[model samples]
Target chain A: MSPLVIAFLVLALLICGSALSMLWTKNLLHAALAMFLTMLGLAGLYVLAYADVLAVAHLLVYVGGVLILILFGIMLTNQTNQTNQTNQTDTASSKNHLMTRESSRLLPLSIGLSFFLGLFWLFTKGPWMNNLPVTGDSKLKEVGLGLLTEYAFPFELAGVFLLIALIGATFVAKNHD
Target chain B: MTDIPVLYFLWVSAFLFATGLTILLLKKNTIFVLMGIELILNAANLNLVAFSKNDPSMQGLYLSLFVLVVGVCEMAIALAIILQVYRNYRAIDVDQFKSEF
Candidate 1:
């Protein structure tokens, strides 16, 4: 296999494996760690797609910002009754052997597998808009220009909305007690 | 056509969506459920990025950017609400919240 394919394979493996591990594990902390790795793989995949700007921003936001936020959440909402620190977050990895808490008798998994297979089939059969001209390398510059020019209004709106949301979150979190 | 196939990205996204759905069902912890939501968000983002790869106008990319911002806002609000819930209930397990009518 080519190096590009190999790289994609490795990153895909990390994303899928960590994500599956996140589902299988019962410990909240382990799932959070797995999520961090999954985000890392996703950032790498974005880079592979030539979205260097998105990759960097994804790394900054998901890995640097959101993961830290998750860790803090885990810390703040301490499961006080737990006797062991590792047990609180690491999940019961060994116990999850081929079985997890399924919501139904072969309904969700069967539906999911069918959906995946259908999508795969559609992808193979449909005429994808492939062979499009690759854009220039400097997406960071283009993104900067677009954010200031065409996307400026929406950008400002998002910022304002984010500010309001953060304030509201703090207000709701704070209690008189 | 460029040699880079979009199927790879689609495959990855499909697996992620599946995993996120599984997490939503399997995990009893409220925080775990939130992580599943994040996974679902990222899966959608992956699709946007993948599609945006071929678009010169970058609309999908722009939409995904907004989605990311919105996702962060959601994470913050949800975590705060979860903290409040923990404070009130002293537990964050979904199974623990049972009230017989």
Candidate 2:
């Protein structure tokens, strides 16, 4: 087995494992941490796939941006029930404030497992172009040029959209006295 | 140099999608549901990136870039809305938002 394939397998394991951990854990903070690992592994997969630009962007956007946003969300939306329980209980159990409510595990797990199996069977059976000469070159230059040139309009639109969303978020989150 | 098979990416993405779906269904917290939605979006992005790995035009790559931006925007807006809902209702659980009617 080649080093590249080994790296891909390792990253895939990391991603799948972390995602499963996120699903299994009820603590919102733990799920956030698991999500961090999942995103990191995903960035590595993007690198392995020769999308280095996207890998870097994914790392920055997900790890640097989205994860922090999620953590803040978890912090801000602390459940009053958990806080009251912690107040009643010992100080050591205060950390359990992040525990979240979830439905019965059986049905969801069975549905997810069946869906995965169905998709796995479909992908393996479907005729996909196989053994094509894979390009190992970086896509940084092409992506930059394409973003500025052929995709220039949409690129600008995305920037404007992001600006609008940020402003709207601030507006919506403000005290509505 | 052995390239990783596209089928491998497909399988991983399928797993991710199913997990995301389950999380969405099982989690009562709005933020947890949002994370599940993020997973689903990333699963689709991975599919696009893997398919575009071979295409000279790199259309899938560009589309995935846009998807990423849109996802960030959605996350921001949804979290903001969630915050407001929590303030109004004092709870972030989906079932807690019962109307007084």
Top candidate by TM-score: 2
**lDDT of every predicted structure (CA atoms):** 0.79, 0.89
* Candidates, DockQ: 0.51, 0.76
Q: Write the per-residue lDDT of candidate 1 for residues B11-98, one digit (tens) a residue.
A: 7887888778766766666788889889989989998888887777788888888999999999999999998998898877788778
lDDT for model 1? 0.79
Per-residue lDDT over A31-77 for candidate 1, one digit per residue giving the tens place of the 0 to 100 score: 88899999999999888877878888899999998899888888887
Interface RMSD of each: 2.9, 1.3
In model 2 chain A, which range of ten residues has the least summed lDDT? A128-137
Error at B74, model 2, angstroms: 0.5
Off by over 4 Å in 1: A80-108, A127-138, B1-3, B98-101
lDDT of 2 by residue, B1-101 (tens): 67887778888899999999999989998999999999999999998888898999999999999999999999999999999998888898988756899
- State every prediction's TM-score relative to the real structure: 0.85, 0.95
